[model samples]
Target: MFFHFILIFLLISNSIQNIFKYNLFHHSHPSEPKKPSNPIVIIPGDAGSRLRANLTGKPSTVHIFCDKTTKDYFDLWLNLELFSPLIIDCWADNMRLEFNVTTGMAQELEVVLPPSRLRTMQRSFTSSALLFPSPKLWGPNETFVITPRKNYSLSNIEDFFTDIEFPQGLEQWKSESPSLIIDPPGVKVYCIYGSEVKTPEQYIWYHNWLFPDYQPYLR
Candidate 1:
C-alpha cells in the first residue's frame, strides 16, 4: 500500500539529519521534601536518542513528566529529542534521577548502587514499537509479522499493539520482541507505544505512550 512505501522511505531518509550530541548536569537536592515538591526536567541529547533507538531498535523520543498528589503537568518543550538535542536543566526538592538510551541489541542495564537512589534492573519479554517517516508517508506494510522469543500469552498484548493506523502513503513495521529499553540508574521508565506514527499532540497520549511507569500520577 501507499502507507508502507512511505514508512520505508522515511526509514531510508532517517539519515537526512546528522546525529546530535548533548551533555548532562546535576543539581543539589533539598534537605527536606514537601507536598507540592519541585519541578524535575530530564533531557537526553540526540546522541542519547540514537543510542537508545539502536539499543532498542524502536523509534524514541525524550521528555520530562512531573506529578504531585493532586496535580500533574507535562512541559512539551521539555521533550528534547523530538525536536533537537539540548541540555534540559531543572530542579526538584526530594527526587533525584537521570535517563539515557544505550547501544547494542543486548541491553546493558547496569545499576551498581545497592540502596542508594541509583539502581538498575532488567526483564526479558517480546515487544515492538513502529516508526513512520511522516504523515504524508503513512501506510501499511504487507511484510509485517510478529515473532515470539519466549512463551507468553499473545492475547494479553495491549489493544494498541494490534492497532496500526498510518497515513495514506506511509506504512509502519517492526520485528517484535523487547526492542524498547529504559536504563536510568535510579528511575524506572514508563514505555508508551502508540497506535500510529504522529507528532506529539495530546498530553494524555504522551503520558500513555511514554510514561507508563508513573501510574500514581494518572490516578
Candidate 2:
C-alpha cells in the first residue's frame, strides 16, 4: 500500500514536470519554426504494452501458465478475477520462498546452483512479465479472449510493442546514444521512477550527476 501511494505520487509529479518542461522548451525556442515536433513516446510501467508471440500468422496459444500449471487451471483463474488477487499473493510467496531456499543453499555451499533450481527461478521471473494475464499465474493470451479474434501478428504490434531487455537494453541504449526514435534528431529521454522502486546507488549517482544532464529531465 505504501509503495502504491509512492508510485501514484511519482507519476503525478512526473506528469507535472513533463508539462512544465514542454512549455518551457516551446516558449524558450519560439524563433525556431516548429514543423511537427517530434512525437513523444510514453513508456508505462511493466506489462503496459500488448504483446503476442506469433507475428505473421493466426493467434497461437498464449502461454500464460509458466510451464507449471495446466491449461484448465489457467482458464479457471481467468474466470475469477476477484479471487485472483489472493491467489497471486500466495503464488508470490511461493516464488519468494523457492528463490530464498535455492539461492541460500547455493551461497552457503559456495557452489553453483543446480540447473533445475535455475529453471524454477526463470519460470518464477516470468510470473509477472505480462499484466493482462492476471492472478500472476493464470490468464489468457493477449489476443485469445477476443471474439472473432482479429488476425494476431507480431508485425502489427512491433511498431509500439517493444520489450525492455534489461542490462542489454540499457547497454545498447547507452552505446547507440539518442536514436530510439527516427525523424527526431535527438530524443529527449526522461527516467521518472517511484521512490519505492529499487535501484542501485551507483546507477542513481550516474543518472543524477554523470549521465547526459539527466537531472533536469528526471522527476
Candidate 3:
C-alpha cells in the first residue's frame, strides 16, 4: 500500500509540472496572428454623356466607412483646385456614408461641416440634370477617375430600364406616359422616361419647349 501511494503522488506531480510548463510557454512565446486590411471602400457616381465639359475632373471619390478590423488605411485624395482644406473632411464623411462603415477604426474620425461652407458644396440633383457648356467643375454624371483625379469621357447608360415602357393599364402608366412633339426647328421632343418621373409634367419639366403631336413612346 505504501509503495502504491508513492507512485500515485509521483504521477500527479509530473502532470502538474507539465501543465505549468505549457502555460508558461504559451504566455512567453505567443503566436503572431495575421492582421486584416481596412474595410473602407470607394464608389464612383455615374456621370452623364457630356464630353468637352471639363478638361479635368474626377469620376469617383473615395468613401470611407468603418468595419470590425483594427486597421485603418484610408488615404483618400481630392482635387486641390476645386475645394479648400475644410472640404476635405466633408468628402471623407460622404465617403463614410457611401461605404456604410458602422464601427471599428472609422468611428474614430469626426468630420464637422460649416454652415455657409456646406451650402457652397450642396447641389440639388434636379437642377444639375441640365447639361451646361464650360461648366466650372464636374457635377453628377461626369466621369472622374479614381486615381490622380483625371477626367474621362462619360459612357452611355448601360441600364435598359432608363427607356422601359409598360402596358396601358399598368399601375404607374398614367405618370410614365410622355407627350412627344416637334418644334419649328429640327429639335424633336424625345422624352426618355425615368423610374422616378411620375407625371408627364415632371418628365418634360426640364425642356419646357414642346412640339405638336403628343406621341407617347411605348417605354
Candidate 4:
C-alpha cells in the first residue's frame, strides 16, 4: 500500500512539472511579430488640393480666373455660371484663340502672362466643368470648398510649385520598427493626376526634386 501511494504521488508531480514546462516554453518562444501595413498619404495634383487666397479670404482659388477684370467674368468662369459641356467647348475654343494671340505678343509682355500660364488656366476651367458636371456640385456653399483651410497664402501656393517640403513629423514615423506598422504605412503618399491634364510630368519632376531621397510611385 505504501509503495502504491509513493508511485501515485510521483506521477502527479511529473505531470505538473510537464505542464509548467510546456507553458514556460510557449511564453518564452512567442510567435513572430506581425509586419505592419504601410499607411497611405495622397497628395493631389494641380488644383486638386484645396487652396484659398490669403489676401481675399476666398477658398478654391484654383477655380478663380486669376486675371479677370470684371465680376461678370468671375461669375461666369470662377463661379461657374451657365456651366455646361457645350459652354465648356465654346470656352475652350475661345482660349485657343487667346493662346494664339498671346503667344504672338512681344517678349517683354509675354513674360507677364506666359503662354504656359494661359494654357493651364484654360485647362482648369474645362477640367472643373467636366469633373463636377453640374454647377450645384461646384457651388460656393459646398463643403468641398468650405472644409479646407481659409488661410493658405497665395505666395505659399506659388512656392509649393517650386519648393514644397514633406512634413518632418512623418519622417520620424518612418523610422519605427517593422512590427509596429499599423493599418496605414508609416508614410504613404500619392500623386494624383487627371488623364486630360498635362501637369503630371511637371509635378513628377518637382516631386523628385523636392524628395530625392524617396522614390514615389507615379500612376
Candidate 5:
C-alpha cells in the first residue's frame, strides 16, 4: 500500500515538474493559472537504473556448467548479446526469482542476489536490469487488474492467422499463452501501443542478426 502511494506520488510530481519546465521556458497565457513551485522527483523509466549481480554461493544447479559464484558484481540484465540462441536460458536463469514458502518471499535461488535484493548503487554496471515490482508490493487497486505474463510468448492471435499462409499450419504453433479468447469490451480501453514498430506476429524463423516486421493489430 505504501509503495503504491510512493509510485503515484512520483508520477504526479514528475508530471508537475514537466509542466513547470514548459511554463518556465515558454510564454504563459495572461489568464493562465499559476503553476506550483513545489519540487519533484524525476520519473524513472525502462533501463534507467543500473543493475549488478554477485554470486554468493549455491548448492547446485541443473546445468553443471552454469556459474555457481562470482567474485564481484557483474552486469546481469542489460546485455542483448546474451539472448542469442542457446545462451539466452543462462541469462534468464540468472534473473529468475524463486518463491520461498519458508520466507514467504522470492529469492534468486540464493545464487544471484542483485536483482532479487538491490543494495548499493553503481554507475559502472553494464546493463540496467528490472527489479520485479510484484503487484502485491503495490497492493490492490479497484481501477485495474494487471496480470504479469511471460516476457516472450506465442500468444499473438494474429500470429496464428499468419501461420495458415506458411507450409506448416498449426503444427508449428507454440504456446505458453494465458488465453486466446477475447471478450467484447464493456468499458473504455485506452490502448497505448507502438504503431510504427514491426512486432513479431508469425514465427517463420528467427536469427539474432535479422530483425522481423513488428506490428500489432489495430482495433
Candidate 6:
C-alpha cells in the first residue's frame, strides 16, 4: 500500500510540473499567432464617419409623424437607446435605403408620386434653382447635356402616357413642369430619358433641377 501511494504521488507531481512548464513558456515568450493581413480601406479624405441628416425632401412620408431628417449630426450604432421600440418606429421611418446604380451605393428612395404631389415638389426644385444660380467660376458658357426621352415629352399627356388614356380635367400636365415651358436663361436644357424606365411626372426625369451639380456625371 505504501509503495502504491508513492507511485501515485510521483505521477501526479510530474503531471503538475508539465502543466506549469507549458503555461510558463507561452506566458513568458508569447508569440503573436499568424493572421491574415487586413486590407486598409482608403476613402476620400473629405468623407467623415459622422452620421448627418440632410433632408432629400421626399414628395411624401410613410408615417405622417415621421421626420425626413434631423438638423444636427448625431452618433449612431453606439446609441443603445435608438434600438428601443418606442423610438424605433420614428427612427425606422427616417431610415431609408436609396440605391444609386452609378455610384454602386445605396442612395435614393424611389417612390412614385401622382401628378398632384409632384406639382408641389417640382415647384420647389425650380424655385430653389433660381435662388441659387450656378457658379460663374465655371465661365459664362456652361455646357448642359440632356438626353432626350424616347417617348413624348411630359407636356404631351396623350402620347407621354402611351396606351393609357390621358387623365383629363385634372389640371394640365404642363403646369406640373414650369421649367419645361420657361427654360432658365442662358441654360440650354438637355432632355435625357431612359427608354426602359417609365416616369409619371417630369420631376424625376430631370433629377430635380435643384441638383445641378449632378448633371455632369449622370450615367
Q: How high is each candidate's TM-score?
A: 0.16, 0.17, 0.15, 0.16, 0.29, 0.21
Task: List pairs with backbone clashes in candidate 5.
Answer: 198-213, 198-214, 198-215, 199-214, 199-215
For residues 82-144, what per-residue lDDT tens digits would candidate 2 score against the true structure? 123233443342223122574564221122434443443443443233322222223323331
Using lDDT, give the best candidate's number: 5
Cα lDDT computed for each candidate against the true fold: 0.30, 0.34, 0.34, 0.35, 0.45, 0.44
Please provide, for model 6 over 1-219, each residue's C-alpha lDDT reduced to its tens digit, 9 standing for 90 to 100: 999768756765666666677667745334667657789787632222233345556566665555666576454332334443334555555555767789999874443543544444444443334322123322223323332343333233344333223333113433333334344678676988779775222222354342322322332
List candidate 2 segments past 4 Å from native: 1-85, 88-97, 100-219
Please state the error at residue 9 of candidate 4 in Å: 99
189 Cα displacement, candidate 5 (Å): 9.1
Residue 95, model 1: Cα distance from true site in angstroms: 9.2
Model 5, position 69, has a per-residue lDDT of: 85
TM-score of 4: 0.16
Which stretches of candidate 4 lie above 4 Å from their native place?
1-69, 72-93, 98-163, 168-219
Residue range 1-219, candidate 3, lDDT tens digits: 999768756765666666677667755334677558679675644221111111122334332322223233333444332133333444443344332355533342234433333332322222332322112333435532211222222232222112222122222222322222223556665767778765321122112122111222212
After the best TM-score superposition of candidate 5, give how far the Cα of residue 207 lies from its true spot, in angstroms: 58
Displacement of the residue 175 alpha carbon in candidate 1, Å: 22
List model 1 lDDT by residue over 1-219, tens digit each.
899768745753452242222322333358745557689876644213211211222122232321222233233232434332212222121122334455434443343434322111111111112331122233223112222221112232322233322221121223422333334558775879877666532123123343223221210
Model 6 bad stretches (over 4 Å) = 1-49, 99-219
lDDT string, candidate 4, 78-131, tens digits: 223223323344334322322246578533112233344344443344233232
